[model samples]
Target: MALVVKYIVDGYHDLMDNKSDPRVNDWFLMSSPFYTLGICLGYVYIVKVLGPKFMESRKPFELKTLLIFYNLFQVIFSSWLFYESCVAGWLTHYSYRCQPVDYSRTPLAMRMVRGCWWYYISKFTEFLDTFFFVLRKKYDHVSTLHVIHHGVMPMSVWFGVKFTPGGHSTFFGFLNTFVHIIMYSYYLLAALGPRYQRYLWWKKYLTAIQMVQFILVMVHAFQLLFIDCNYPKAFVWWIGMHAVMFYFLFSNFYKETYNRNQARKEAKAAAAKAAALNGKPQNGVHQNGVEKNGSQKIGICFTSQTALYEHSSNTNGVKSVTNGYTSEETKTLRNRAFVPNGN
Candidate 1:
């Protein structure tokens, strides 16, 4: 294992040592529209075609022993990366000061020799994000935002390691590592059970942390872009695009999550009022089971059909985001049960 890591470390050092500006790499990746297009299209194919097939093969969302083991492995993987990053940072503080450190002659001079390989390897491991989602069969949750974020982050890190392996490299990985601490832990609990759902109320805030990470990445790149930080410009811009896209995508996410959702609920209320003359269109299932009041999955009458979605995990499951209803409102709707005698 140490020998494998040494070769990988040597590989990283040979490439990143000469890098003068991070933005050069950044532009190369961003300039090629195909890079972004290919990943997106690939995920699209996965979602539209492969996604259904994958879901069909597995049971939807059961916390079996395999998932338990996966979660445990995730903890180990993320924790190792986090520790390795700290070790790399400590070495980088000395190696890049005033003069660059030469690693060809001496092996120890390489920043946490094996740590860099761990860093690179962890990038590919992140692809498991989507695979697990597919395994768990949370199809509706697998939106474009989910796919792109999962797919791009790992590749971005791969390029970052390929171009610049140490020094300010620690900066990007550290923030991400810290976030992963919370993120992976959340996933661990989420995999275990819905009892952990309340703890996940701040899932949106995780995106907020991602936004902060990108902003900091931009700042790191800007320093290298202007002043005498010896990262690569091509590399800086290459990774910087990730930051910018993350900001725009996540900002839009926040609005869609918090702001746009409210506007939609208001619009829904107004439309509901206009249609209320026929009957107060309280959001609920009608007698015929077609969602007369609200277009929900379950019906007004709790027949055998309602049992499919009533457990709250099926088609008639929680519709909190789309129609822009809050958790509170969703709860109210679920409890009311849409009887014709009631509003």
Candidate 2:
């Protein structure tokens, strides 16, 4: 155990010593991967293990006010991140196709580099999303996909900050932060409850927006391979691969949550309609087993003919119109009928 710790410490220092970008060397959590990995693992241990175990005998915490503030903070923070990214990457001397990381000490270049670090740090802050869920004991919300996404993002972004802080690749950060601004704003509104429900219908579209972001990132990254520029090919490939993975994940989620459920609902509605149409009271004059003119109170039921017509009047034995059973053959056919209860 001592040797393992020594090895890790030595490796962390060696990695830090190799850095060429002096601008990012002193930034928080940039010296080594260990700090970020430790925090991420600690987060997992708390939310997945310790937090749930502690809450076993207790009721879930509401954390309503905390969530509201947290989400609002995210909205503002992401807006700032996005704005900085745009001003640095788009408004400055950036080549959208194949911009390389700027190691210069110029003001615009430094702003872009700072924006990259901010985006990386933002991934750490997003862990609070899962933390809030754990505090609230919303275990079902802490899905495997959610964990993978949040867990992998910081480490990935860390490399972005450490290696290629600002380039064509940083565009991913810009697009992503833009999406998060909208996303966290939605979350903030949703946390406020019923008054915001009307505006929250677009909540379902959040996944769609995320999938679109991944698609855009993939497009932007793949364009690097076709052109000749200074941006690292390795980072471009990494970005493209990550984008595809996220796209697949989000698309699968969208299909399962929206498409399959919608299809099932439509199938159910069609079955109900078919059943209702077949049970129309003989002359097609009834609506949902009740007479259009409100004369009778027939209900759509599937029961034996004897049970249906036993209570009806057979004064002239001319067949019963009330229960829709005409003759012995029709009555014994065991077909669907509109039988009123206690009529």
Candidate 3:
């Protein structure tokens, strides 16, 4: 046991001495991985366990103003990160096909290092997203995907800053920062209230763009395997696999939320069309059903079918009129229903 412990400790120190970036060794949260890992674990515990329990008996806090400012800050911060990433490497000198880490103290290289550190710091601030959800009692938003994504990010990026601060793998951070810019902009508009809701019709597209980002990252990183790139193979595989994993996760979420709802709407329209062709009520109600103001009443026990017939006759068979449109007009409207593709 003693020999095993000594061997593990020796191996860890050797990796740190040989593989870690010495320039960031003295920087905040860079001295060791333990600090960042500890903070991440604490974040998960609070969001998943402690937060919900505390809010169980309490009223949700009104955070409209806070959310507005928070989202605004995120949008501006993400924009700055995107700009820095471009200026430091992507727009200026970095190659998309193959780029290796510049470990020297050159001006552009050090700028990339600083940008990477700030990106790492940004992950910690994102914990506020979950905290706000918990405080608002919006527990459904703190889903397994949300928690896992936020929880692992800090530590995952820590290695990049520690070993390869600026290289091919930084492309992931570049794309992610860009995505956050658009994402927080949406959130900022949403926090402004119902008037801004109209602009939020593109919410589903946000996920689509995110998926696109992952595919780009995957292609950029995985291509390093086939060609001779000066970048580290381990980091290449690491970054590419992360993209692959997230793409599938986001795709599943899209299918469940948007595709399923669309399928349900289509099914309802089909049923209504079938009913119309059969000379029955076309608006999802039975002919023998009692109708009040063109809507069917539930659980109203009529004494007999004759009573139901009498009620239908008095109401003129419920009129088949909805929102000033006749049954034929409503059918036309349904046929012309807008199935959104994109902006």
**CA lDDT of each prediction against the hidden true structure:** 0.60, 0.80, 0.85
Please report, as a residue range, the 10-residue window in candidate 3 with the lowest summed lDDT. 334-343
- Clashes within 3 Å, all models in order: 22, 0, 0
Give the C-alpha lDDT of model 1.
0.60
| Backbone clashes in model 2, listed as residue pairs | none
RMSD vs true structure, all candidates: 14.9, 7.9, 10.1
Model 3 segments beyond 4 Å from truth? 275-343
What's the TM-score of each model vs. the native? 0.61, 0.77, 0.82
Q: How do the residues 268-338 of candidate 2 rate in per-residue lDDT, one tens digit apiece?
A: 78866876677754344444445443544544444443464454444343445664544344334222454
Task: State the TM-score for model 3.
Answer: 0.82
- Model 3 per-residue lDDT tens digits across residues 84-154: 99999999999999999999999999999999999999999999999999999999999887888899889
In terms of lDDT, which candidate is strongest? 3
| lDDT of each residue in 92-172, candidate 1, tens digit only | 443322222223323443544345546655655665566666767766667677777776765665554444555555566
Query: lDDT score of model 3?
Result: 0.85
Candidate whose TM-score is highest: 3
